[model samples]
Target: MAKLTTRGLRIDSGGTGGGPVTIAAEDVAGALGMGRLKPQAVLVGRATFCDDNRAQLELAKWVQQELHRRCRRNGWKTDYCEGLAQLCVFELVHPLRCVHCLGRGQLWLQVPERRGERIVLVERWRTCPRCKGSGRKRLTVRDRAAVAQIGKSQFADVWAERADAMLSDLYGLQDDVLRHLWKQFADEAA
Candidate 1:
């Protein structure tokens, strides 16, 4: 599926076989039933200046009007419009997990079975019936040296750095529009 981050609204559609293509906000918004939301709304802040919310709304309204205009021009399937609108809302809603990992970072790891021939699998230790001596489980580690290597989240600072990097992208143009419009508007206006 094509996952488009349109103004922080992720709209997934029938992708082009390859990966999803990221297009301009207008294109994605239009595809996802944002015909009522204007590309102008997206571009206006980025391109021009409007201090008040009403100006931005006007721009968005203009964009929606344009989307509808294009629908008529292109003879698009307006029937799918509702579904696309739902996609718009879905995009705005906070995603539970990262689309990349689907929440879990590491893929399922298959533990290697111990065998008689392997040098590491000497008689001293047989298959770790629990982890199969793979040391896969964080708590279970037959290797004393390896066990010491595991590091905890030690400090909130370390965790904070990871939090900053690991979490889904927290902010975007549209996000600012919704939250910090004055700053964004000024930034864009400047």
Candidate 2:
């Protein structure tokens, strides 16, 4: 048997190379000073990057649920769930278009043209102020409010800010996962 100490309490791990040991949820709850811990779902199978991503999403979903439950005691707790949902959905469904340029990638500016004895306004093209040269930008509070429900519209500003940071992290995680998957596939092919 192997002994492990946690907070001055020693735990026995049966023996070395004992495969995997399963602990009761009640035991974990007792350790954490909780009344009880009941698992809602358990997913067991071959793990892959895709599975890892799914598990992470599931965890996020659970966190949102817990936040909502806690909102009964404190109203501010609900914002966390709303913010997380908005951030996740912003990338999945809401594609951004520069409001200033109207997705044209450029702005039409009116310039004064001197022609002989008369001055006339002529339309000139300039890069979009909102999105620079790219027609697309990240979803903004206004953009979200345009299509969001009355309830969702209230948290648009807050969600947009958090969504920006979350989106960048999500993109990086996706890129890493794709690279890993590609390398694994290439290795198997060779």
Candidate 3:
């Protein structure tokens, strides 16, 4: 008797005087339903952004458009205004919890045991290794582009603050664009 095994399927007999049998790649893939292996990607702000924040980002986009319109109307010269708006919006949104741990800061492990002819599964929770029990992680990035863009926004804010103060001291009022922009930011913060 000859035995052949593929993915735990055992063949105990070969009717022909066969040394080996070859299987086509397509046949195996079709049998395993490999065509359905890939999933459609979901569009979102950050790779690590949670579903709960999706609606918040949408609302922030509306605010960003409003700010952009106001800035344009005021003839303000701001580089990366669109990117800054998005980064500011994301910053305002609450920090996302660790996707690996699902905000639980812990992981549930399944242990299987054989009991007679049946398998019993048990689950236990332990601190998540990825989050280190903090339950949060910074957003995932494809590269340093996101970090650089965020840095630009921080510098813009600082420069705007100084320019606002200087303009106010010289003219008895702050720059209208900066005042309006910060007001919108404060509203979003609240």
Off by over 4 Å in 2: 1-77, 93-137, 145-157
Task: Give the candidates in order of lDDT, highest first.
Answer: 2, 3, 1
The candidate scoring highest on lDDT is 2
**Which residue pairs of candidate 2 clash?**
none
**Which pairs of residues collide in model 3?**
none
Instruction: Write down the TM-score for model 3.
Output: 0.27
Instruction: Tell me how far the alpha carbon of residue 3 in candidate 3 is from the true structure, in angstroms, after superposition.
Output: 64
124-174, model 3: which lDDT tens digit per residue?
787889988757565544211363254545545543343333222322211
TM-score between candidate 1 and the true structure = 0.24
Task: Give a tens-digit lDDT track for model 1, residues 1-190.
Answer: 1132434323222231222223455433233222232343444433222223554445444444444564577675343333222222222232334333343333344546566765342333233444333223321122211222222332232322322221112223344333233322224334
Model 1's number of clashes is 3
Q: lDDT of candidate 2?
A: 0.44
| 1 against 3, candidate with superior TM-score | 3
Clashes found in each candidate (C-alpha, N, C closer than 3 A) = 3, 0, 0
TM-score of each: 0.24, 0.35, 0.27
